[model samples]
Target: MDRRKFLSATGLGAVALGAASTSVGAAPKTAAPAAKGGPAKFKLGCQSAPFDDEHFAFFARYGVRNCSSSAKILDPGRIYPTVDELKTLTDMGDRHGVSVDMVDSVLLTSSHIDREKNPAIMLAQDPQRDRDIEAFQTLIRNCAAAGIPAVKYNMSILGVLRSGKVKGRGDSEYLAWNLAEAKPPTPLTRAGVVDADRFWERITYFLDRVAPVAKEYKVKIACHPQDPGVPPSGYQGVDRVLGTIDGLKKFITINENPYHGLNFCQGTVSEDLRDPGTEIFDVIRYFGNRKKIFNVHFRNIKGHRDNFAEVFPDEGDVNFLEAIKVYKEVGYDGMLMPDHVPEVPGKPEARLENFAFAYGYIRGLIQAADHLA
Candidate 1:
């Protein structure tokens, strides 16, 4: 969809009714605006995927306060917008009341490997790497130039994928989970087999090169865990860094810094069949106060690996109420981007609709809790 048409079609009307109008009631009470100083009022947002500038503009106009960028949207190859084009995006953000909350780099999993093998993937690896870690450096530069404060990166071996068998269920309920399957039936590169250690080294190397850059720009690098809690198999050729809780802690220990943080994805942690409250609270209690939690990907999931289904935030096993309470208690002022949403019916515009729904739901929850508190 073109920008103007798309914006007009799905713009502020969704939430503006409440935002722009005053309530008529017994006392005619007005909702308080989000407070500042003590803590930045937490906000609901979505990833910049299923791409459309208007879709994002709609979210912004509707009250979305933050965004997690996708590689599809930001990389030089895709949008390929010039410096002028980027200025246009910044102008668009200004016009729409949106801020680039977090700039996401390539998944340190498959995308990272791709970079190591293919020169094209070499984002700023000189000879092998780019001149200065090109893609990440570019992202940080754009964010800094745009006045964006943080950027999140992942360190999983494989990020998100569900089998056709699962997705084909269509009407039936199913959970997206990781398979304990091996990857790469045959060698794709000159290296005999890309193993776990090599992947970890490359990741560290990437971080070592890029973390300083992020620091220079004041962006936070949030490393997400490998979902499903499974290490890469021998036959799989794929490898993971943060496949387990211990792995996450270990990774933190290795790269200790306030700037190097975690993206606590509740659904991925729940895939371990553990209580989401415990997992989320533990991370926040440990990291949030330190400003080590760069952001969050909030969604509810049911069941364990090979048997998980995406559900509405309140419908799943995770305790979002407690999660939010913990978030507030810990002063988690970072962006809370909705991770996944079941496709809505008759909504051909999957990206914007889902994000709109999520934003509304989370906003209601947070406001309700704030009122009670």
Candidate 2:
């Protein structure tokens, strides 16, 4: 269906949850408990980098109840942490009152994969494939032992690539990426230009090996989508998979284990479709209704595909209220964290300011949607 028709059918224009007028004046006030009822339908969370007591405290002050720690905190040198180390990190979360819902951006380094010359070789049938698989299994086991329910990761050899910046509110700098104006970097592996089929085959092999292990550990593997949208076939000397809906569906279908699911990055999926409203909502319902969404990166952008700027939750193209409504409709009870908020300029507490703004904005939306429902 056309974008306009889809918007009309989905009642996008009818959404009344406009931007909140109240400025985030100070550190967030402690949220009051729900009135004599069951638990909240969904929880608010954030991905704090350099995850530490200070960061957890900051989030807690803003009423965040769950968090995903930066992968670096778990494995500083990209070597997987031991079970004791993982438990220590979880203990830190308990002290701060924020549950560590997941570990963000877990990856196997070139050294662990044992393919320093071209780590992408590990993505295919390489001599070091066994080593790479073992590294991932160990990481998953340790995370599960430490009480982490999910692990978010990327399967692509090339991670997120952005080209430029855009001005946001208060002249804050937000990162932007335009594939049309960007040059593709050279392929990283000796086995260059792996086709889509080859990529799928290799991913299937990896999942086949890891899916059983994940089920055994009772931990979900949340596969993140390719960022900045996949380039046109062969545009970047590679057939980019997992950047489209079809690619994502294939990824999920390849492994039937309930433990294999999506990280459900709203912004990246919207960028791939190049429509942040209707298309984004459809994808949300598609995966969320099926319970394939393990977690969510709840952020928004001003544009789509290569030409986009991450903005405040309400200021972006996606109608977050409607998005939250869909999540409720689908019964998605997992963590939904604000990802990629632009820095507010000049404030000594710029990160805190941005995060507080996002947290308040999302919290308001969630409440409004639930009340309306």
TM-score of each: 0.72, 0.82
lDDT scores for all predictions? 0.55, 0.69
Q: After superposition, which runs of candidate 2 have C-alpha atoms over 4 Å from their true positions?
A: 1-40, 70-78, 105-122, 185-191, 344-349
lDDT of 1 by residue, 216-310 (tens): 77767777766655434522355444555545655665556666778877676565433343444454455566666777878876544333556
TM-score of 1: 0.72
Task: List the RMSD of every prediction in angstroms.
Answer: 12.5, 9.5
lDDT of 2 by residue, 42-108 (tens): 8888876768888888888988988877544444555566778777778888999989888753353
Off by over 4 Å in 1: 1-40, 50-53, 70-85, 106-126, 130-135, 164-175, 178-195, 232-235, 272-278, 305-307, 344-347
Q: In lDDT terms, which candidate is top?
A: 2
